[model samples]
Target: MKLQQRLIRLSVGVLLLGLILHVALLLGYEQLTYRDRALQDLRGRAQILALNSAAALAFNDTRAATENLQTLRTAPAVVLGCLYAEEATLLAHYSPSGARCPKRPQPAQGAGSIRHVESVMVQDQSVGQLLLEERLPTLAERLPRYGLLLLSVIAAEAVLILVLVVALRRRVLIPVHDLAELAARVTERRDYSQRVSTHGSDEIAALGMAVNRMLCAIEEREAAIKENAHLLQALIDHAPAAITMKTMDGRYLLANQQFAEQLGVSTEAVIGLQDIDLFPTPIAQARDQADRAAAQAEGSLRVEEQLGERVWLSERFPLRNAASEIYAVSAIATDITEQRATQASLAQALANLTQLNETLEARVAQRTFELKQAMDQLVQSEKLAALGSLVAGIAHELNTPVGMVVTTSSTMSERARELKAMVEGGSISRSKLTEFLEDLGAGMSLIENNSLRAGRLINDFKQVAVDQTSMRRRQFDLGALIDDTLHALVPLFKHSGQRIESSIGPQIACDSYPGAIEQIVTNLIQNALLHGLAGRKDGLIELGAHVSHGTVQLTLRDDGKGIETQYLPHIFDPFFTTQLGAGGSGLGLYICHNLARGILGGKIEASNHPLGGATFVLTFPAVAPQRASDAS
Candidate 1:
């Protein structure tokens, strides 16, 4: 039963019990009082009759005695009985007609020759004994009146109890029950606006107030969350990058409009489809490999993949659950096929420019031999025009490494000085120096133990800046070249409390100018650390290099402030900087862009890091060295 019903029943039961006990006690008291009163009246009348009878007998007046007896008999309250001593002499008796008294009634208090009796005596002799008995009124005369009175009192009490029950139900149970129903409705419909009525300052009213307050809080939080979700959806819908999410087992969970458009499919078709399901042969393999790598590393992985005639710059990252397990993967791809074509065209242009330089140099030498004075002015003009374009492109390519070298070399010089001072102060003993020498002697290390990194930085820069200033090709491990570039730049990152982490795949051989590859990697790492972590104090820079199909792809990323969507498309432009004035030379990425395109026979692009930062990806084709016969 409900609480209200239980309470009401208990209350009624208690009231009924009290009323029944009270009625029973009252009836018992009334019955006992009536019986005592009747007995006393009978005793008083018997005493008067006995005294009068004794006086008449003592006077020897039979007539007076008989008259007195008749008079007593006529009295409304008296019944007379007569007796004779020893059953010999006659005596008088009186009783109501048809009222039978017991033939022998023994009385112990007094007797007229009986064992116990109330008697009248003459000259010390007992004439007869008087026996009186009291009779109570009948049920027909009194029981109906008493029963009516009892029933009236009970009816009044019952009416009072019912009134109180009705009042309680209205003032307490009704309001409480209404509030419970309102709560149920609110839960069913997920509507928080319905409120309970508060009629008084009782506990129920307080409960209503608490519920209203809770609903208000819930509504406010829900509104804020919904607003955030709307804003995020708007961002995803309009983002320039193609964004999508897929299950860990390779089923697509969601694909934004941009991704759908890039894949030339509808969003409905793209969702729930795996890479192999949605994409054709080669591109699907690249995507699957990237997804596996991302899941394995539990981090982001980027790969350059070709779909039909288009090139996509794709990044895959593991989406983790609360338990730190990879639950899904999110991918963002940018179409860079046009960018790659532009880069190839630019490389061809640079090669033609180089051929023109060599031809002009040879022509100048020949003309000088033929007529030194006549062709001087003409040679100079040709040199200037050819030099101008070379200067612009090469300058763009050199700026990144030059800037990084300057930064890293300076820090290395400082560290060297600090080491020198420590040694001079006896912090490094002669025994420690001997141990270091022994360790170094154990390997044929080309770079010096003390200044190897700084020296390599200088050497790498010189190959691009001076020694191999012309477009020259060589066969080398592209993965190793990237690794060496990151190693050289470690000091600069160390100065900023950051580390360079690399995942270079096994000996990826490529025929390309190492200077260009070095410059591209240097620029990417520098940009990731400098701009990606603009305000960060400590961070990590990840460099990954691998050979797939006929190309070597390198990805550099960092944990820092991610790029804004508006600025992502324009990062590779000549002079675009999100950090307008705070020491941001837009030429950094611009240089990296041109080098990857012009000198390295590759393509470069920038994007927002999925794990929150910036990422630069470079893809270079593997080629064989040009033989002397082929050059001719």
Candidate 2:
């Protein structure tokens, strides 16, 4: 603020603070002194009255006590008084204001009112009590007087300060304001030649001289700055790179001659123009994206782009202000079309030579790779063929039960037809009808059994095939499933003088891929009958299951000529079967091994028992690994 204003504010603030404190002290002192004197005066009057009323109270003279209390009228401030007899009876009371005497309660000692209670005694014996109450004067009742006095004092102080402020405004403030005005002019016009007038020999005049000297220095520095800026602008315009400044939204703020020429426009036309207005849609979009990327990155970004026949390598960096915040993007684009063309020519020459040398080697390597891929495809095809053969065997097995069901059902229909004819001809007999129903019941039972057999076979084949194909995990009753599979293979051993004995528990359960286990069992059984018991009679194949250590142990042994000692090690190898000439395909054991290790996530081994038998044991996790839904 101006000197005069600051002086006035300082004076007024000091006066207001002093006045507030003075008024508070005066109010406090008046209340304290007034309350103390009023209390003492009331207590003295109460004591005197108490002494005088002691005689009246002793005699129980109500008239004398009343007369004694009536003297309280002389003290108009006493609102009420009371006299009590020796037995606490009210003998006399007085109220100068015509208000009834308040009940003689305990004296309430506080600032607002004076309550004095003195005991009345005669002959050193308690007689009566006298109470006097007087309301003290409140500050509010004398506010006008104190307020007027405080105002008078503040007014006198304010007048004196005003006179001093006026003098300072003329002697000091005017000169300081002159210096300030000169500084303001220098700042506004940027012409720092003006000097403040030195009107007096004082500190303020000296300050005026200092300000004029500062302006001189500033003027010289500004000239140097202007010259440097001119040189910098010239260098920027002459630079080979096409430099431009643009907002994040792609609007050009400034552009050099080279940048304008690259866009085939003048600098004036380039400024305020967006990329889309100067370039094709694709190029414009690319440029805009680069600008936005630089802004979002809050740092520098580089982009290499092909525009028409030229290649431009542009480096865009964020332009920050005094606050170190990115406000715009500055891009310097260099044309690299000629350089790229030269490099392309060199590359073409080298590629021609390299192609001649690498053609044969590349072809050879590619053929090798192709042949390896073909072999892998062949192996996969063989696996799929084996799976197809298993499906075909299952289909063949299903045909028998389905054919039996069809044949039995047809026979039952014929029997029904015959019975209907006999009834229509009225030649039906009781014995004949009974025999017919019995046949019908047998036929129904046959159909149900066959249908169920077909269903079970289909279900088993489905689960096995699904697990083999996809390796899906599920919970299954191991014993029951094994029994069902054995039953399904009953026809194979029915007339072969062979027995398949199972020593599996009824409650053995597993949470794994049952289909994989089924496949393994089927292959092992076929392998045993085909290899170990090719020509033997009374062949016995034993299968057993037990659970331990979180794994299911399945053991299958055959009582026949055991596997050859030399071939025992390769027993589970693919295409290593001795009966390969008899259409063994050599994949059964290999598939079993893979299913156990990969699908069922387990292991299997083969050994020759000392008792002339080949035994195969497979162990697998009771709980299979979780199935990946997206597994191919």
Candidate 3:
């Protein structure tokens, strides 16, 4: 709505607000006065009745008291009334509605009703009490009359307001409408020199004068702006780069001479034209996409364009008005065909250099492959060396017991020969016989112990050698297997003065490849001996195995120096070792890791123990996973 209409509505709203407040005040005042008048009238009537009943109450005349209350018939609002003696005994009562009065009611005070208690006195002494009640008129009963009066007044005022509105619209709105029409003409024609005429000395007339002065100032500014725009156009026309301004819908608003030349059109002809009107469909579509992207972006965009066998690098950016809204897209383009050609030549040179570098890399890769092959050969050799060590240990262990048994057999045969010679001469005595039997018993005991020791060695070596060679799956006691592997590994430690603590927990049965477990254990123990011992001869290697919840845990700890921090993470990587040449082929722990995880379905971790040494933990399921075979 126009300001004129708003002002008229505001004036009428103010009048209605004031009228509403006045009506509220009237109603509030009437309610309070009504309550007071009702109470006063009722109190006066009750007091008169009290005065008249004094004689009856003093003589204890119930008949006279009843007649005095009967006088209340004229006041129908008095619903119930009662006369009481000094001791609160009822003397008489009256009710226009035939309702009984309450024997004991709290004294109430409110606008809803009026209850008056007046005392009867005889000769300055209390004789009786007169209670009167009256219901006051409610607001509902009087609202219709007040409403009628309010309507009549409102109608009269509305008529007056309507006349005043007509006068204001003519006096103020007419001039405002004329000024608005003048502004519209100036804006439509883009002419700031237009001005509204003034007639009176009022605010509307003064507004017209101010607008005239503003128009004069704007007209001067507009002249300066036009000069600046012409200068800018001349500058762009002479610029080396092609420059143009396009609206959001792709129509050209300003095209410099350079841009017009590129489009094969005069500058005047290029105005209001679009890319689609000048270029082919493909080129036009590409340009439109780039322009739209730039207009939507928060900043400028750089893109390449192909136009008539020439490549141009364009910087496209949004053109925003004073309100920071993008109204068009402006682009500046420069041909870069020669520059791009030079870049292409340089790129080819880089490609040739890259090929030469790749050739050198291939030679280096070949050398690395030869070295890796040597390392792999050492790995195979180390496996053989390990098995040879096991055989050597077994031989050394059985030698001692075999020698003991052979020596005892030879000594016992010599003793038997001496006994036979004595018995043949018939000179054998009881003492000699007894000595022979005792010597025989001692020799038998020595042979028995040696035989048992040899048997155990052979049996353990047999089981381990078969398992390691066959690499087959089977169920066995893990604790016992560990003990056997350790036994075979005894020679590695025995001569080195390293002590081993073996804690093989009970009931550790496993359904897995014993050979893999054996290989992993052997590697860990050997790795510990070689690296973890750190050249300490008396290092302690603790090997433990236990089972719980169908899983087995095997841990190997060494009292040697812990693994070097820099080499810890790569310890289990193939061909990664600090020893490299000194007893470590760099594959011991790597092989152990592979066997434990790949064949035994277990996880292995290596860490430096807090106390001292490197710790390797291997955990595996007791029942190994059934693996798919190759080519399956």
Candidate 4:
């Protein structure tokens, strides 16, 4: 039993013992008083009978004496009565109804006359001695009835004691039992909300009050613990790095939102699941090893891992329970894909700078001799510069068609592989071969269509390249250029479940390189769709272009996960990419920036949108109207 039950039992036992003792003492006193009063009544009756007998003897009338003797014989407590002369002769005798009195001893001369006897008594008289016997006949008749009455009183007292015991049990024992059960439940469940109720100002009530206060304190502490847990969970969920908690056995116990998203799975699906369940082969083994290292070391462990095309910096820390036992391992991963790329790029730049320094040093030795033939050298330099510009223009023009060809070839190869699988699986039966052939013919037609599309892009690239190399200006609709760029990138966005909503106002003619503007818009839209939507399923890309004042402004925005505030400053750096080896060239944005400023004569700025996403703003100067005379 718990302390509460023990206390109640002790208190109840003491109370019952005290009550029994009190009742016994009271009953004993009552019985003693009743016995004393009965004895006194018997003595007084005997004395009165003796006095009446003396009066009868003093009259000396036979008939009156006989009547008095009869009256004494008929007395309730008198068993026998008689009248006699001084010599102690029996004048008249009477016995109590249905009872015999014991024979009394004769009184000696010196012996005291029988003043009081348990049997008979005689009174001194002139004619004869008046005798009276004290009989217990009346007492005998009342004895059985008194015994029955005493038994009834005892039975009533027993019933009252029983009722009191039951009341005490109900009021005290039952509540104490309930409180004990509640306490047991609190211990087992670790839930401290339960409390006992006290009804009145009794000791049990005071005990209940004390218990309730203790429970309140425990509950308050439990609430504080829960609040702390919630705060910690919130912090983990909002953390920028991918965080996960795994058991020592390599089962995931908890994962933050970013971790689940990075793994391309739901948090619920990842919990209690081992790495092998989500990933294949070496990745699972690597994760298991890391978890074991953390547990064995009883400290933090860090390792760099390459999963697919991205590199991750993973740190694991041993999570210990209250008993200092290793319960789990907490792993935090930072996608260091971009950082690794930056390091590689820095190394390449150093090599290039070294090469450039070597070239400069080689040319420095010939500077004094070249000064005499400076004019001829200048002429040769201009020719070489023009040739270099021409080669750059050709390379730029060829880039569009090469990109188109590569995209088409990859799509065709994937389709061919699918068709081969269908054939091998018998999904396409011999009977359906003719239909398959027809489909193949249609696919060839599609290839031709795409080929022409690539040619058109090539033509546009050539025109823009020629214009850039010749330093020629032309009038072109900015809205039309944006529309063309959107059309070209529509297939890329379509596969990713993204829709572009464009709000192109009335055509604003601009005197600039139209191809450069198209390239800039294409790079911006592709970046928004890929990086912005990263791991998201559904997203929207909006492109708004219009004439603001004399400048044409174009805004491209996407409703995807926005970039972190810390990374905003480094976004425009050359060869920087959030996506490193996952088909990111890093030159897309760099080329776009250069084209916007150098060719389109525009300024571009990027910022996080208020609604939650990334936005790029581009402004181009309006084209000036030229007369036919001025053109001539």
Candidate 2 lowest-lDDT run of ten: 352-361
Q: Is candidate 1 or candidate 3 better by TM-score?
A: 1
Model 3 residue 205 CA deviation (Å) reads: 99
Worst lDDT run of 10 residues, candidate 3, spans: 462-471
Decreasing TM-score order of the candidates: 1, 4, 2, 3
Query: Which pairs in model 3 have colliding backbones?
Result: none
> Per-residue alpha-carbon lDDT of model 2 for 378-450, expressed as tens digits?
3466445546544534444455455555555555556666766665443455577677666655655655555
lDDT of 2: 0.69
Highest TM-score: give the candidate number: 1
> lDDT by residue for model 4 over 240-346, one digit each (tens)?
77899888778888999888887788878899898998788698898888788878884688878888887777888898853578888898987767655544443
Candidate 2, position 627, lDDT: 57
Instruction: Using TM-score as the measure, name the better of candidate 2 and candidate 3.
Output: 2
Q: Per-residue lDDT for 4-31 in model 3, tens only?
A: 4545454454345345646766577667
| Two-way lDDT contest, 2 vs 4, winner | 2
lDDT of 3 at 27: 72
lDDT of each: 0.58, 0.69, 0.69, 0.59
The TM-scores, one per candidate, come to 0.34, 0.30, 0.27, 0.32
